[model samples]
Target: MPAWTDRALLCLLLAAPAGLFLGCSEGTGAEDVGIVCDPGEGQMCTCASGLGSVAWCRIDGTGFLPCECEAGDEGFGGETAGDGDGDGDGDTGDGDGDGDTGDGDGETGDGDTGDGDADTGDGDGDGDPILDQACYPGPNDDYSVCFPIVVPAPLPAGYDYPAPYQGNPNYRAPVRYLDLDAIDQSAQVAANFTLDEFAQSWKGRYAVLQPHAVAYVQDLRDVVGPISVNSGYRPPAYNAMVGGAGSSRHIYGDGFDLDPIEVPLATLEAACSNNAGFLVEYESHVHCDWRNVDVDVGFFGLPNGDAPNELPLLAASLEQDPHTGHWSAPASGFDEGEPVRRWTAFAADDRVLTQARGRTFEAPPETAYVEVLVGARMRLVGEPLSRRE
Candidate 1:
C-alpha cells in the first residue's frame, strides 16, 4: 500500500476510539437479540416496544414497531420480543395502554423508577435486574438514559455486532445521565417518524442513541412543517462514496439528511452552525456538520455559497403545532419577499459546527412532521409532545 494508504489505515485505527469516545458510532441490537434489524437504505431502526418494556426481553428483527409498554413498564433500550401465547412467534403482548414504555427511566416497565433489570429471559424470577451496575450516560452526548452512554466498543468477534461506541473521557468527561433512560425521546420531532433512533456497535460495543440527521430534522421541523430524511445512517462503505470528510463525521459515526419547510438553507445553516457544540449533533442534510474543533462558531449561506450578514427566516418551537396551523419563522432577516432567502437546506445532527464548507445536502423525503407533533400533542406518547407542539 502507498504511504498515504498506510497513513489512512492508521487514522481509521486511531480515530476509531476517538470517534467512540467523542460520543459517536454506537451500533444496533444486542448480540443477545436473536433477530436482525435491517432498516433499508437511508433508514434507521429500533426494537419492538414491549421487548424493551420495563423488565422484559425484546426480540430483535428487521422491522418497524413501537415497543408496547404498559402504563408504567420501564426499558433499558434492549430490543425485546413479546409473545402473548408464549409460542415464540414474537407476537402477542400485554394490553397496557401507557404508550411506548420502552423509552422510560424504569428498567422493569413497572413504572417503579428503581434501577431495573434487562434480562427479561434469564429466568431470574421477574428478569428485572436490581439496577445495579447502572451508570448514566455522560454530558454532551444524548441527554437520555435510553441512549448510548459508551461501554467500550471492542473489535467484532467474528460476525457479531461491534461494541457500544464509547466517548473520549477527556472532552466528553463522564457525567450522570439525567432521566434514568438517558434519552429524551419525548421531544416533539417531525411529522411521520418519531425521532430516528439507531443501535450501532463501534469498536465492539452496543449503544442506543439518536442519529445526528434525526436530531437535525427534529430541530428544524420544530419551526417548519414536515422535515423528511432524504438520507440517513449509511454503513462505512456507503459513506465514502458520498464524499464524506477526511474525518467524515459519518464514519466517525453520525450524519443525516434533513428537509425543513420554513427556514431557508442559509438561515438553517447559521442557526445550526453554532449548535454542533453538542457532541450528539448529527450533520449532512443538504448542508451541515461541525469541524473537529475546541472552539465554537456558526454561519449561513445559500447552497451555492452566497450569504449576507443578515438573512430572512422564521422558526417555531415545539410549543406550536402543525395540527393547528402551518409553521413559520422570522421574515425580517432577509430583504422583503426575496425568494432567494427561503430556507433551502440544513445540516444533520452534530455537523454544521464551526461553519465548514464542502458538505452534502438535499431535500426531504416526507412531510409528516405535522403528524409527529400531533401525536405528541395528544400526550399519547411518553415524551412531552405538548412542549414540542
Candidate 2:
C-alpha cells in the first residue's frame, strides 16, 4: 500500500460505517464522524435544570460536548450574586450586597437603618445638615460671638424699656440677646475691646452688643491708637440706675463712651466724626454710636480708613427652600446702586468652602455658614441655620 498522510488516514476513518467503531485521537471518537460544528466553536444550550449554559464543539470538528453550567447559576434569575438578604431574591436592601443595616426601600442606604431624615434640629424639617454653632474667630485674630438672628416676641421680662423710649424706632428691642454666664468674659470682642469691657456696668449678664458698634470702635482704634471703653451696653434698668438720659444710645447697644489713652481728646473726637453715626464731644471722653451709619455690621475693620459713603448695609435674611434645602437672599433694593459682588460659604472652622458672583449661594456639603460681600465693601453674614449633633 502507498504511504498515507495523517489527513488521508483521518478521512478514511470518517468515511467508515456507523457500526465500525474506531477511536482516532484522544479528543476524537467514532461518534464524531459526522460534522456537527467547526472545531472549537461554542453555542448556548439549556442544561438539565432548564438554565442557560455553554456548549463547545469537539476538537475533531464533530458533535458538541455536554452543556456546562457556571458557578452562581442560582443568581441568574434576575438577581445579583452574594446578596445576603437571607431571602436570595436580590431585590431588598442596598445593592452593595454586604447585608448591613438598611432601610429596605430598594434604594441605597447610609447604613443607619432609618429613612432619610435631616435631624438638623432647626424644627423646620427642611433637610439641611447640622452645623457647628461655636463662636468663630474674627479677622483681628479675636473671637466673634453671635446670637440667633430671630428676635423673640414679647421681649424678655427685664428687657422691655419704659415709656416714650419704647415707641422710638431707634430704641426697638435688640435682634437677639447673649448670655454672659455662658460666654468667656475675657474674650477679645474687637481689636482693642474685651467682652468684659463692653459688659461693664450692664444691668444683667444677658446683654446685647451690636456688631456695628464693635466695627466703629475698631475703626477709631485704627485712626488713633489704644483707646478705653468707658461705657458700652447699658440696658434700661442699668441706664436708669446711673441716671442716664431717657433716650440714651447706650441702651441700644451701639453707643460707646471712649477715652483715648495716648492721643489727644481732640484727635479722638475727630476720628469719631469720620467714623461714627452720632458723635458727642465730652470733656474727658467722646460718646459715639453707629445708629445712623450705613455699613457692613458684620465686618470688623475698614481697610485704610476707606469706608463706603451712602452704601446701605447688606441684609442678612436668608430664605430657604423647603424641598431643596437651598438658601437665597431677598432682593436687595440696592441692586441698582450697590449690587452684591460675591457670595461665600464657610465651614465650622472658618474654612472657605466656595465663592460665587451670584446673589444666591448653594452651600457645599457640610457647610456651617454663608456670607455675602456687597458693593465691594459691605459684608453680611447669615445666621447659622443648624446645630451639630
Candidate 3:
C-alpha cells in the first residue's frame, strides 16, 4: 500500500406507505398474465404498462393502464364493456348492473375523506407531496425514496470538522475527519456525533467518543476558548503514512493536535497540564490525549527543574545512540554561567530533537535544536514517554 502522506489519498431506510404491496412482474406468457394486484384503499402501485407507459392502481383497486388523453376515445383503460377480464362489465364494477353507472360513488362516502379520492388519504385528491412519498418498493429495497428533514445553515457552520456533525453544537468545528461509512454500518453515528459533516476517506473512517478525552477538550476549550483542531482520529494507515507512531493514540481516536490560535502556547500548555492524560508540545502544535494509562505530567521544554524558559542554543550539537538510533541531550549547551536547560529526547530526526524530559542527557547525532517543544510525560512527573512520535 502507498504511504498515507505520500498519497494522503483517496478516498437510507425509509418506511413504505401502509398497506402498499409490490410484486415482481411475471413473464408475458398467457398463463403468467394474472389480474393486476390491487394496492388497496389509500394506496397506489406503479408498473411499466407499455413501451413507455405506466400503469397505476388507484383507490379501490381500479387499475388504470397508461392513457394518451387526446380528443379521441377512452384512449387508455376506459374499456366500455369490461375490465378485459372477460367479466363483461367494461368498467371496474360490482357487477350488480342496476345502471349503477360504475362510478363507485358511494364507495367514496365514509370510506374516503375529503374530495372522495380515497387514495389521497387526507384527500384533496392531490396524493402526498412527491418528496413526502414514503418508501415506494417498501423500505428495504435498494431504491426506496424518502424526503429527509435537513437542518441547515448556522446549525452546521463548518464544512470541515466533525464535532458539529456529531450533533452537539457545543463542540467546535473543524474536526479533521468524520467517518460516515461507520454511521451507515451502525445506522447512527455514535450518539455524540451527527452524519452530515462527515467526509469520505480510504479506510477506518470513523470518529469515536471517549468521554475522558472529550472532557479534557472541554477543559481546554474552557480555558483557551475555542481551540481549532489540527488533527484527530487518524486511520492506522494514515497515521503511519504521516510519520506517526504505529500505535498512536490518534489511531484509536483518543488524541488531538490543536491549534492554539486564540491563546498563547504557554496558556495552552498550562491548560493541558491541568486536564490532559498526556500532554506534548510539537514544533507547530500541541498534542494532548486522554487515556486511563497512569502517567506523570510531561513538560516539554516548559522550564522544568530550574530550566530557563528561554530558547536553547540554535547550533548545539547532539549525540545519537548507534544501537537504538535514538537521541538525547540537554536543552541548552552553555556551561555553568550560562542560562541552560536540560533535554530528555523523545523523537529525533537528523536535524531536530522532538521530545523533552526532565534531566539533560546525550542528544542525537546530526541534530540541531529547532526550538520545538514536544514534551510527553508518561505515568509520572519528569519521566516522559517517547511513543507519541
For each candidate, give its TM-score against the true structure.
0.27, 0.40, 0.31
lDDT of each: 0.27, 0.47, 0.34
For 289-323, candidate 2 gives per-residue lDDT tens digits of 77564322111111111222332233445565656
Show the lowest summed lDDT stretch of 10 residues, model 3: 295-304
lDDT score of residue 90 within candidate 3 = 29
**Candidate 2 ranges with C-alpha deviation above 4 Å:** 1-157, 162-168, 294-389
Order of quality (TM-score): 2, 3, 1
Query: What is the lDDT for 35 in model 2?
Result: 46
Considering only N, C-alpha and C atoms within 3 Å, which residue pairs clash in candidate 2? none
lDDT: which is higher, 1 or 3? 3
Largest lDDT belongs to which candidate?
Answer: 2
User: Candidate 3, residues 174-274: lDDT per residue as tens digits?
Assistant: 22233334334322222222222122334344443332354456557667876776676665555666766534555545577776767787688788878
- Model 2 whole-model lDDT (C-alpha atoms): 0.47
Instruction: Judge candidate 1 at residue 162 and give its lDDT.
Output: 22
List residue ranges in candidate 1 displaced over 4 A: 1-192, 195-208, 211-216, 277-285, 290-389
Q: Worst 10-residue stretch by lDDT in candidate 1?
A: 295-304
What local lDDT does model 3 show for residue 82? 27
Cα lDDT tens digits for candidate 1, 1-389: 01111101110001132221111122334232433332110111112343322221122222212222332342222223333222222222222312222322212243332112332222111222211121112222232322323222242232122221232211121121112134444432223444333222221132222233344444554545555555443333444455532233333223444445666554554455555522221223343333232210000000111112221122223222235432322222111111111122222342222211211112232222221111011111111223345
- Give Cα distance to truth, residue 147, candidate 3, Å: 21
